[model samples]
Target: MAKKQHYKHNNGAMYLMLSPYLLLLFFFGILPAIMGVLEIPKPSMANANGGWDAFKIVIHDFRFGPALRHVLGFMGIFVPLMIFFVIGMALMLDIKHSPWKKWLRMAYIVPASISGAVAVLVWYVILQPTLSPIKGVLRYFHITESSQIWQQQNLVYILAIMAFFAAAGNWILIQYGSLQSISTEVLEAARVDGASVWQTAIRIKLPLISKYIVYMSVLVFAGGLQIFVEPQLLNGGIYQGIADSWSFDQLSYNLAFMQGDFGGASALSILLLIPSLLGALLVIFKTDMFEGAQGHIKKKDVEIVGI
Candidate 1:
């Protein structure tokens, strides 16, 4: 009776904690997706009266190829670097009795706290050799000219770096917290079994936290596809056409607002969403991520999964 009661209590607490995220996901993610799907069939100038024509128009656009390449390039650099560094730094921080752990955690999140237009402005200044505090370093890298740093070829690398720093801090702390969920007893056993720290982290901790890594990958990939602000702001703020519609998101924005083709935008968004959605479903359903150690899905998880 007591065990059942405790389990129910835990379930309630879990749902309570998840409620805010659920609400946001429903409102911002699911609702928008639904709306985008509906809007896909609506008539539009870009589509010349929409009905999958919007999809054709968007996919066939000249900007589409470059945008896809740019975003793919950003993800190629950002996602791996993010996963590697975030896990590495989190593991480094999780070392027992590390004196600087708390300070380092705080340092990691400071950049994340600086957000929105401010982050854009800050990055702009930082990337500019003449204005940046690290001008000497920029010059060392042969980026003395804004022309050098802001070129078409260098934009992918630049965007990747900017996105990585902006996001890595928060992910590091999240992954670190995930690390803390690991059983100290298990870690002790690993040590007792002559497993070195590296071996334990690689062989034990990494596998234990694999689900979180998948979650991060899905979100990171989705966010990478939705890259808009950096390219858009950079284009408008400094160089007028350098990264103009350099991402699919920017292209969608231009289609909807500039070109007055909401249907095309919605179709494009749906097309972009398919990969992230499929990837998430594959990870979630194929793995035993939501299952308990007993090889059954937990009741709470089952209920959520059903929904």
Candidate 2:
């Protein structure tokens, strides 16, 4: 009777604790998701036509192909490079007792606190060709005389660097946390067997932390797909290199405000939500990410008869 009462009390406490999150999920997450899929009636079409023409038009738009390609290209370059550099930096800093670890970690995390816009502005100053500090060095070696790093062709590289600078530090912190969670006894055992640091890292540590790396990679990839402000701000808005509807988000913004096409904008917004939704699903279900592998293990006793 006491155990039954205890269980009931625990169940009530759990429900009480979960109520706030349930409320938020229903109102914010589930509601918005449902509304996003529903067809919105447009003022312009209320009388002219009552059909799915707006969504069909957005689906067949020429800008859709180029915008998707551009965003995917950015993701291709940004996600892998970000993961490699961030994980490498995290591993280097994970030698917690090393003398320079504190300062090195500090340097990596400092940029994460700065806004993306601010970082882009800083990069613009540094990559401004003639006035840029590196440009002077490049000029000494007879590099180009032009003062623009914001060239049409170089936009991919420029955006990649900007993303790396803005995002790598936060990923490093996540990787570092994962590394810290690893048992010290495992490292000690590898050391006892006279395994070199490189060998241990490759054969043991990396496998252990592989899921964390994949988790961060998918997260960064999703973020890269949603990139907007850096390219827009760097291009000075609606410029030649970056079309008005270069990215999906940019397309939605332009449709809503610039072109005054609310229905089209809403359609674009629903389209843009696809990649993020797929990424989130992949993170949650496709990978053993949120629940670490340690949770799945069970201890069992085996008895041996005297032989």
Candidate 3:
């Protein structure tokens, strides 16, 4: 009877400690989710002329498909490109023979500390038509001053570059840390087996850090879907279409404020919420992210390439 009372007392204390967190989760997470579901138009209201008709109207909009396509294309380009760079840089920095690993790592991560908006503006100045550092090269190529890269067909490339500057450093930091976490014995075994640096990195180190790669991919995909700041800040009113329906988030914003379609904006927002939520769930349940930092690839689990 005394032990049972003691257990009840401990349980009460635990609940008391968890109360604040539970309250915050309810207010910020659960409450907002409930509100979002309420905002989505039901089938009856979706067929109406105005209130919840946003679901029907937005789906039929000409710009809807293009907006999704642009974001998907950007994700397709950005995730793979960033992954390659991140892994390459991480491998370079993680090299046991490197003399300047610390300084190089610092240099690589510095861009991540810069604000996204500021990074976009800095790229804007460099890519601007007349003020660009490469203006002379433009003239050498016989390109007229009336046209610029930002305003030309190469706008997609320019957009990708700006997004890279804003996001690449953070990913490098993640990849580099993952590489560092790898046990030295595994790397030594690979080296003993006559594996070159590239082979060891590609085969052993990459597999060990596979979970990080998966997490980063999901994160980059979700982030890519929500892209608005880079295109909006980079264009700076020089081009109109870059932000009008360039991304779904921007499209939802335009619907809400520019067109006074609150219901439609809410509907679009709810639709976007699905992917982000799914990605979060994947990281939480599918990956070992929350498994107390044990990491996915153990030293014993890796197969030597040359042996």
Candidate 4:
């Protein structure tokens, strides 16, 4: 009873401390989400379902279709590949006696830190045939012009690579940290059962950290869906309308600022947000991730008692 009370008191104090940030989140994040629902464009007198008609307009628009395809394709590539590499690298990195571990961790982080405009510039230089170190490879593929490389169809691969480098490093370290939490006792028992190194990692280590991976996947999907800066900077920076409205976010930006269609922008935003919200709920329920989170809170409570 005393421990429960102390735990409640500590949590209450923490929440109290966090109130300001929570308030700001409500004002900025939650408030806009709520407002977006109401701000969906209202249709004309001819259309009976005004909001639905407006939403349909945004959906059926020519630009919306291409942007939709681009985002879906981008997510398809980025999500699976990112998960595979992050997990594989993290598992390899967890090797007990690896001397390169410390330096390798730094190596992952450094590239990840070079993000946003810098990443765009870095990738641009690398892709630019005259400037690239891989100019020989480009020429061998018979690529001579920027147009050959920067085609609309190839943006999927281009953006995926940029997004991967921008994010995969941090996720590798995060997955590595999750790998560290696997109990040594369980691992020893696996060894006693004659499990090889790869076998132990597959059968023992992965399941323990699976929830974190699911959580990471959910967030990555959400982030990829909201992709803007990469395509935006590419189009706006140098290419000038080459990738204009290449993503949902870019389309939404055009609706709001360029076209002055706030309602359409809000409608588009709501549409994009739906999948993210559903993905989060799916993770929480389908994986029982919320239940696992409760255990973490209990673990913290036990730690407080030890203190």
lDDT of each: 0.85, 0.72, 0.74, 0.86
Q: In model 3, what lDDT does residue 139 have?
A: 74
Model 4 bad stretches (over 4 Å): 1-19, 42-50, 136-144, 285-307
> What are the models' TM-scores?
0.82, 0.78, 0.82, 0.84
Task: Compose the digit string of candidate 4's lDDT tens values, residues 1-307.
Answer: 9999999999999999999999999999899898888777454332335665668788877899899889889999999999999999999898774767789898998888877899899988888888988889989998878778888789999999999999999999999998888888998899999999999889899999998889999999999999998899999997887789999999999888987777788888998888898787667555756774765555455355442
Instruction: Give the top-scoring candidate (lDDT).
Output: 4
Q: Give the TM-score of candidate 4.
A: 0.84
Residue-level lDDT tens digits of model 2 in 204-278: 778899988878877787778777787767555424455446677777777677777677777777777776766
Clash count of each predicted structure? 0, 0, 0, 0
lDDT of 1 at 197: 87
For model 1, residues 1-307, the per-residue Cα lDDT tens digits are 9999999999999999999999999999889888989998788776665587777778999989988899889889999999999999888887775767788889999888765566778877888888998888998888877777778898889888888888999999999999999998999999999999899999999999998898888888888878888888878887899899999999999998998888888888888888887777656665655555535544566466553
Candidate 4, residue 280: Cα displacement in angstroms equals 2.2
| Order of models, best lDDT first | 4, 1, 3, 2
By descending TM-score, how would the candidates be arranged? 4, 3, 1, 2
Flag clash pairs in model 3. Answer: none
